[model samples]
Target: MIALQIIARLLDYPDEALWAHRDDLLSALADSQALDEENAAKLSAFIKPFCAAELLDRQAEYCSLFDRGRATSLLLFEHVHGESRDRGQAMVDLLDQYRAAGLVLDSKELPDYLPLYLEYLASLPLEEARSGLVDIAPILALLAARIAQRDSHYAVLFELLLAISGVALNSADVAEKLQQESRDDTPQALDAVWEEEQIKFLSEQGCASAEETAHSQRFAGAVAPQYINLDAHFESGTAGESRP
Candidate 1:
């Protein structure tokens, strides 16, 4: 719902109000006449993933918004790592509070930070860390540094992320059939069980069912999103109204 609210605000708010304060814009959107439960739920479900990414990306966009040196430093760190909280928080603090701390390093010194970044990566959940492996060379490079720096945990984590991301992207035939094991007999050995669970949930929910709505006319393009929107029904929506 938050994503939907943001999209709605972006759509209806005045241009001057667009990039002002996110909190203020969110509040104004909640208060606006355009917002409603159904549309809001749809919007939120669509934008949730991108919103999370955007919140972090914005810090990288504006230097003076935080300590410029630290902000840029954190981005490079994040490109090769992950952490408990969104890395964007560190970027925000660096650019905003330490913008001119006189700590800019030479481009060559960038490699020196790989160990620190790998330590941060190893501290994260494997699935979380793999999300940063979009550019695997830097990730592998950081993993090598981590191994030499007495932080080999990240090397393992980096490999797991790569294996999982690869399985998700390339091994769809095996991924779709969870009944069949990939390299091991156990279900845990399967790389895509997590993704399969989602597909299973959709199948169970009749998302692909051709059954018509018993009352209102069933529309096209209503199945899969409706399944996703089920999660978006929080404390406020048609589904939430049933909660006592």
Candidate 2:
């Protein structure tokens, strides 16, 4: 559905490519008949000012909201599987599913990046896409509540996604959870997180002292990136094949 495609692009980084096509994106949402009157109006209200703002401002806002903490991470799996071996395997499994659906990714994006996942869903039948959203409705709902707590315009997008999913989710439950949760994106919280993470890494890696941790850091080599290379399959001479 065009609404899915539009939202897929909308969730992506606010680069010039998306900015340049803002008018077309709005036009498609209206012409697609995929959204009802209220959703369309809410989305339009968000997109109008979002697109009208200066590019630098938009980029900064995006980074502030999503890049600062794991709370608003756009990686779908990050919310589900944080620093676990199962997450790695799940990503590969998802990549396989994408290939089976003729959704070979052309970029370096992870298989579970929410925007890319939405793009994959956009290529499916409307009901199937809705089902896909429903599969992750709880995540979307928590995201909606969390972003709403931040008083961000992006909450509308999550709310729209949940609305589209048509799931029987409880917004009140999510809000209650949010009420009891402390903010993780604050500078103090981030620093504490890094310190705790270092301690955890040292313990997990058998570093018995600060000296061993320091030595390990001094000798640390290039760390492998955490990504399932979606481009690997195309290396078999099908790189130029059109995506679904």
Candidate 3:
């Protein structure tokens, strides 16, 4: 009953009175010895997706905060007294709470951005997906800026991350298990080929290291240097002198 109340409260969201009541709800659950591990796990899974979806809905309401996509939900908070304002904040608070508890944010689907970012994410290989998690901070930074500017990017990014969360979590589990098993499981021939190709493509495109690749471009090398050393002096002319 206590855990159920937490779920209910989380769904309720940003209600000042309700937010104030969450601790009591959580404490009630924590104090209750009747709650079983199976029930607790079920409760955790249920809240996980609900919080994720809730964030996605909020991001949809603030589509302008995003780089792509138009706002689909008309029922958005005007930052005035309304359900939208409360609902949005409630989701954010819920996510923060979960993170505080050590749950990871989703890294795949951008709910508002949806199917499109999903497709882009799907195109990348397992390694890319793993690395993408690290690069997510920059994307989040962009979304944060949008949110600051009253744009809807956070909603989009949140949704995307939620979608990616399941995949990331599953991947992590598999990786961990494989490591424990000493990778006794063998990959299919085609899977091996595909994985190899993905690594090569990402490496060549400079996407493997997002920070480095982002700065370098694959140019045609058509334009030459504007100025050349006429003297072609191979030695360092000025060792300790400063030139203005």
Candidate 4:
């Protein structure tokens, strides 16, 4: 759980405060039994570059990598639903689940933001957290592959996430999915993606619809049935709440 929390923190935009505690955080992670030596080393390796860099430089890199494009966006639904109505509905559903569990988001972040999602998972019991991780494994795999293609150190974080969930990454499948869904984030491409008319393939062939349905079904099956009692977590004040 602490490892998850640390990963969540690392994924967030770097800042002076975070930099101040960098060593302490790495030490805790290195000593955590939840992570084996290899994973701990991978995490350390991922953090080391950013840690050695100036905070401002790291912040700029974060913005460039995650905020400048949809390809490596940290928002989960961006990959699955794009700018479609289904994405809106998925956000609402996820927010409802968070509220039901008494987990409130004070920030303006959407429910599908990966760091926020990871924080939520860190709050759950280990089994529930692992199940939650497995539910989002596809998205994680896609992001990991995309980051790895760019040779970014952040790929390790996603790899560790998949490892934690016991999910194997299918590199070929991830590559195909990325090729189909990922678009350049240039102004022209953004306009095309946000155009009034839905793309013919996504709308007519129901690619988005089918994928959304599958993701929804998988998420619902993972959380709703087994964790319905999480609602009671609200009343009992036991469910943990996190903020970005």
> How would you encode candidate 1's per-residue C-alpha lDDT over 1-244 as one tens digit per residue?
2222343243221233444454454354455333356544443443343234454354443222212222122235343234436555655553442234333334342322433333333334555433423323333333323332332222332333334333222112212322221222123422233444455566678773433232112222222210011112222222222211
Writing each residue's lDDT as its tens digit, candidate 4 over 101-173 gives 7898997888999999998988888877887886676677677877777667888898899778765443334
In candidate 4, what residue range of length 10 has the lowest lDDT sum?
221-230
Q: After aligning candidate 2 to the native by TM-score, how far in Å is the CA of 200 from where it should be? A: 4.3
Each model's C-alpha lDDT? 0.33, 0.76, 0.35, 0.71
CA displacement after TM-score superposition, residue 86 of candidate 3 (Å): 42
> What ranking emerges by lDDT with the best candidate at the front?
2, 4, 3, 1
TM-score of each: 0.17, 0.82, 0.20, 0.72
- Badly placed stretches (over 4 Å) of model 4 are 170-173, 176-244
Q: Residue-wise lDDT of candidate 3 within 162-221, one digit each (tens)?
A: 233322221221222222221101234334434545655778876677543432332212
Better of 1 and 4 by TM-score: 4
Candidate 3: regions farther than 4 A off: 1-64, 67-115, 123-126, 133-136, 148-156, 159-244
Candidate that beats the other on TM-score, 1 or 3, i.e. the better one: 3
lDDT of 2 by residue, 21-116 (tens): 889878888886668899999889988999999999999999999998787889988877778898999899989989999877897888899999
Best by lDDT: 2
Model 1, stretches more than 4 Å misplaced? 1-112, 135-244
Clashing pairs in 1: 4-43, 4-44, 66-95, 66-96, 67-94, 67-95, 67-96, 67-99
Model 4, position 171: C-alpha lDDT score: 37
Off by over 4 Å in 2: 200-244
